[model samples]
Target: MTALAPSPTLSETTRTTPGAGWLLRLHRPALYLWIGAVAVLAVVLLWLGGPLTDSAATAWREYDKSCDTGGSCRYDQDSIVRYKDVYAYTTAALTALPFVVAAWAGAALFGRELEHGTAQLAWTQNLSPTRWLTTKLIVPAVLVTAGTGLLVALHRVMWTAGDGRIDTADAWYANLTLHANGPTTVAFALTGLAGGALAGVLLRRTLPALTLALACVAALRFLADQLMPHLWPAVTQVTSLADGYRGSGLNVDSGLVTATGAHIADPGCGSTIVAGCKTVYADLDATGFYTTYHPESHYWPLQLTTTALVLAVAAALAVTAFVLLKRSTAAPARVRTEAAA
Candidate 1:
């Protein structure tokens, strides 16, 4: 009759009331892992960057030419484009990590309780399913978003030095930006939340919920990157006919060197500036070679816009939540072993 444990409100089937401690206990490991990884990445990147190093002169010397006759002043076919180092590499990496992290968080938050049948007991504690869901959503979302912001800051610091020397569209650069609607990180968050909620309603199990979230992320990225472009009309490339033209034979601005690459063909290739070419091109009557180079305006908009559109697909998946949860009940199918433990 020892007060009967205050009339024991919580059923044995319900999960522990899960105070703030519960969140820390459950999530700290993951938080530490990511933080550690980011730290290592930051250190490595900083060392490689050589904070005091100066490469502006070298970069300019390596590239910078003008047009006339043949066109295409700069020749850079081998090195990794600098803009790529800034935009494409960092964006791709930053955008991808969030997907997995978001999915993991979603699967953990929504799927766990439902799968455990603890939802019923937890709900009875003056809390609706929505309240419980809200707590779950807010905590993890903040953590992930904070982490994403930090990573973005880190990227900005690490790559700020390489502003020129490479167009942001060549093999490495892509002027992707987040200001566009439903950019990659935003899409990852939306999908993660929606995935968790949807998985909770549909699978009613933790493991399955996590699996579904990961699978959806992967499948969607693949579809967006590979197939989606073909679904609509292609964005025709805009070439720079102006950048062409190495100049006429008499112009002497061809920058062609005689002793350099002159064998079968006219090796009359000098530095991009006029002084470098001299009599080489004049003597050889050097034939100009030009290739199509897409215009700068076309670089940032098309791919960035397309990427945003593709990421917005999560919106469709998000809508499924209301339908699935509404049709399903929180009550257990039978019994959950985790509840007793």
Candidate 2:
């Protein structure tokens, strides 16, 4: 009766438990739903693509009946319009798909937690905060990147084949342009995910989270495509030589690229090669009709490089969100309660 009970052994106290993957397993129900949706979408897309791609081309050839044959052919307006339509639809699908998937993943990431207040117990579990968040974040991220990259590649093929329509005003501009397909889209997708998470965290309300997420996506994308490209250190078209020849130079519209040296305007000489004289040229690039030339015959390098810079901006935003998530001071349940109140 006087003897005291012995304490439990270390092994008994520390019972075997599941690995870190359990954190990820929580999303299994959502994943199953997503898989079913994707399967259905795949079947539908395959059916749609038949008419849009292979069949459209076949139909065009038959309707035209006689293309410039006998080793000579040229694209007519009808051909250009049809071809552009194919590229436009492909581009629109590609551009919209990223937003669709990213938004959904984003919604899932924070929505479920807020909806059920499950993070309270989840954060207190054996898995460290970093591991828990990482597991949760990374799984959806992988799915998003893979799905987005596949669609983007398809867009690239269509765009390249169509030589890419250049109207930024067009809703499908990003799809056609992101064909450079490097760090830029990486940044874009990450930004989208971060935006979703942030929306979920801040709003604490599902409809608001979705609404704000989409609005932010639109606003952010507009800034990226509309504002960032025009920033300083922007790539410019310049002549290689000092005395470079310009065909149909100087669009009076753009006010940019003003004449530098003395204007040698027609001192009574038509088609006469003036030996030691200078002329100025500039253009707005409107309609791509202002025919000024540049040293770089191809702008692929500039396009890709600038695209990378734009993507970097997105990456920076994502990093900011990640840092905020990691260092959030309040305990999960406490923060949620405070947020809700």
Candidate 2 at residue 201, lDDT? 60
Q: Each candidate's lDDT (Cα)?
A: 0.50, 0.48
lDDT of 2 by residue, 1-341 (tens): 45534433323322323233453354556566656645544443444344334444554454455553543343244544554565555545555654664566447666556556554345555544455455556677776666666555544454443332222112323434543233345446655666666666666456666666666666666665554334324223333233243432112111122344222232322111343323322231111111222222223443466556655654664565556666663565578799999
Please give, for residues 64-128, the per-residue lDDT of candidate 1 as tens digits: 54333354655443343443354454456566665666466556666776777766667656556
Error of 2 at 76 (Å): 14
Lowest lDDT 10-mer window, candidate 1? 247-256
Candidate 2, residue 320: CA error in Å?
A: 3.3
Q: TM-score of each candidate? A: 0.53, 0.57
